[model samples]
Target: MAEIEHPKPFADWETRAYWEGCGRGEIVLQRCGACSKVQHRPRALCASCLSGDIEHFVASGRGQVYTFTVTLQNNAPGFREACPYVLAYVELEEGPRLLTNVVGCAPDAVSIGMPVVADFTAPDRDLAVPRFRPA
Candidate 1:
């Protein structure tokens, strides 16, 4: 079996809340205090209003698959064994589209609008990757 290559937080102050929320089994999204719009890919300022007044909020961990693909080729050595996996863009309940892996179903069975819920695994690691399963 190939070694598991996990995701770690970016070395930036603005991303601290996101990683910390994950450690606590929470899904955090950035909300613009000015425009009141929620977004992902954590940053200091809101993408819409460019306002530095932003706050962190936890999501419901429920979403629907906006799009997805079945990856049959894993070029990376660590992920080679997990090939033929499903990578999806899930439109979270809080409004941000998140890139995540869709598990608990056949790779070929994944489809648009399929409901999914967040599942946290191995939180003790330096990095905790959020996974999803059919709701």
Candidate 2:
């Protein structure tokens, strides 16, 4: 089995709870209390309403592939094995487009509006990264 070279997630005060949620196999996202908008890349405030009141909740883990590209090469360590993998932006059912990798299917099969679901991969104890696959 080959390893996919994905970026390490940022661990900070604003995002600690999110990573913890991933460890428990939940796809988490932030929702704005003011606008009821979902946002990825969790923050202290809502991006849509700019309100400081944001709530973290588990996502349905179902989404659609908004866009994607097949990478033929990578310079990052341990990422060469995933040269032909699909890197995609998935639009969650919750209404946020998140940056993630699409797997469990042929790269050629990936297309816009394709349905997908979340898959969590932990390369190390402290890291839990979210990848998506064909639903």
- The alpha-carbon RMSD values of the candidates against the true structure, listed in the order shown, are 2.0, 1.8
Q: After aligning candidate 1 to the native by TM-score, how far in Å is the CA of 131 from where it should be? A: 1.7
Give the worst 10-residue stretch by lDDT in candidate 1: 1-10
* Residue pairs with backbone atoms closer than 3 Å in model 2 (clashes): none
lDDT of 1: 0.82
lDDT of 2 at 105: 84
What's the distance in Å from true for residue 123, model 2? 6.4
TM-score of every prediction relative to native: 0.89, 0.88
Off by over 4 Å in 1: 1-4
Q: List candidate 2 stretches off by more than 4 Å.
A: none
**Number of the top TM-score candidate:** 1
lDDT of 2: 0.85
